[model samples]
Target: MTDGTDARPVQTRRNLGIDLLRGLSILFVILNHLGLRIPLKKTALADVLPPWFLSRLNYNGYEAVFVFFVISGFLIAGNALQRWGGLERIDLRAFYARRFARIVPCLLVLVAVLAVLHLMAVPDYTISRPGQSLPGAIWAVIGLHLNWYEGRTGYLPGNWDVLWSLSIEEVFYIGFPLICLLTRRRWLLVPLLVILALSMPWTHAALRGNEIWQEKAYLPGMSAIALGVLGALLAARSRTLPARTTALLGWLGTIGLMATTIDGAVMWHLLRDGYMLLLALSALCLLLACEQRQRRGDWHAWRGLDWLRSWGRLSYEIYLTHMFVVFAMVRLFKLAGGDLRLGFLWYLLALPLCWLLGAAVERWLSTPCERWLRAALLRAPAAADPRQPASVAAD
Candidate 1:
């Protein structure tokens, strides 16, 4: 009896739930990175928890990265679908231009800054040891080849280890649009999703007990992205749900996510693959439920979380810049002869520091770069009409 138009919104606001989740994920990432070298034997939590728990909990930063991938895929794919009708008609140039503008400039700046810092702080460090020059370190970072020497070199120069994730993202930035362009058939998407899901386990098994596996895990970690695309597709196809049902699903999804995290350690190796699948599903379900609830005017509104959401909005900048602050802290602690240990207190201190650095970089560096890039990309005549207006376009 109801018309299709009644089921959809005329305009949609930003989803606060996603913002909150992203913010929380970034916080976890900072904690994980900061705690990497903390002696687990010294901590009560580590003592009480099983090895499985420690491993899973310790690696939760990777999970946060996966969640970001999902959000990216969902947002990007949703936009692509709306503009191109299944990607067949996508404007590849504009897509690539936008992606390059958003990612490359900041990345280049970070690499340059790190390079300069490495030169100033440790003039002797190099990609090759004993006789090589510090410029080798700069070359490794700028070329995104840090991972190649990570195992042999012990540590990446100047906290550039985190750039591995950025490298994976860059690869995706180049490849994902091509994927969409090549596989425009709707039927192919589901199969492609299945392949991505299957490929992770296969690749993991193939690379097990290998350092290369750990370094390249980000590339095979496309399952979350696939889940996000699925969520967007579901949103496009389905109607809003009843308020009570939406609320129930939201709670269920949240519980599932927590359970997945807690149980992930216990289920490591044996159920790691299953855990990822379940986590992605739970996140997707939560997103769907939240979307429905928002439509039905039943979504939760947390004022304190707005700050977190704002951080999430600037997460890319934060993620890219935090390494510099962490490296400086590490050096300071070393100079003071202080033991590097992970504790709740360390997180309390580091989190704020990371946020402050992120804010400063975003305000001073990323924002201006973004503005310039946007202006450049939006300047061309073809770019302006990359897609037809929705009003005049046909479904």
Candidate 2:
């Protein structure tokens, strides 16, 4: 039932729930970005939306990014654990190559295109800061080091705001595999969970007052990832839980998410601690629910949602690239003397445009580049096998 390593080709078909969640999250992210432009006026649409919705929307789009991280943890860690016996069977070289192939090509292309736009003195779009140089920005985006620096200040350099989440993903890419490699003992999972629980308070306390904490606390965000990894471990080791229990957990998880949203809105600073715990618990519950559905053979099937799942598959691209497109759109609108006012109609128009641009990048540029890189990397090792000394002779 896994996507990556199952002997059978993993179903490329989309799961309805996952896709819907992904699309919803991406939409929220866009709204959040747009909201940043409009002030919180009493008469505005921002004032009409529930405080919970506003809380969930932005402030660096943490909610969406958090959902993404949990899903990645569930899927990636689950795959790693399923193939655990093949611990030695892992192709570290290929694993890294695949990771690079998946991420780098689309990113480099976007960076190059953006750089060209910057140089051409494109009207209405400004890329450089008064004191910051283009080479530094280029280096930051490419190296993924920008998150640490840019996150410290509340300022994002132009259209590159989305790079922060990509930085977290890159960190996970390095850390999660190593965790699987090192925590081979079955008993280690317990200690890992314990350590994750213990680390949260420290993370919250250390980063609480600092604005950068919003970004730097990505390490604390690993708690949810650990929750997902724990779910995978359970799935790998145990049969289905009681159906009633699964249903309860699923409902509880949904409720937890709602409660977290409400609490975040009404008592944000007061309930911050409890809200963080709830977010982690909610994500864990979701993982449990998905596992239960898989066991029951109740696969999600719906055409519209399947399309969302396809977008989820390309979410990394959408997440990383969408901000640039959005900023560009805003600049264009501004130059055309369009109002910066927020409204249902403006958001409605913007949503489809963002999705369309994301789809275009995924199809025309990202997907093909990823495919070529993967094919080249996978083929290169096989093609060069003759160059290796015989294992028997070396031994």
Once superposed on the true structure, which residue ranges of model 1 sit more than 4 Å away at CA? Answer: 1-12, 38-59, 121-155, 269-272, 334-344, 380-395
lDDT of 2 by residue, 1-395 (tens): 32233343222323345555556666667767866653223115555676445545544256666666666666655555443333323446555665776678777887787677778877433455454555766787777666665655455454666676666667766765666567756587557765774465467666767776454456666765666666666766778788788889889978876666545564347665556666666866776776676667776467756666555555666776666656765666667665544434455666667777777876787666656765577664222111111110000
lDDT of 2: 0.59
CA shift of 38, model 1, Å:
4.2
* Count of clashing residue pairs in every prediction: 0, 0
lDDT for 41 in candidate 1 is 33
C-alpha TM-score for every candidate = 0.79, 0.81
User: 91-156 in candidate 1: lDDT tens per residue?
Assistant: 676566556556777778876766676656653222335533456555655665555445445556
Instruction: Using lDDT, give the best candidate's number.
Output: 1
Q: Residue 42 of candidate 2: its Cα lDDT?
A: 18
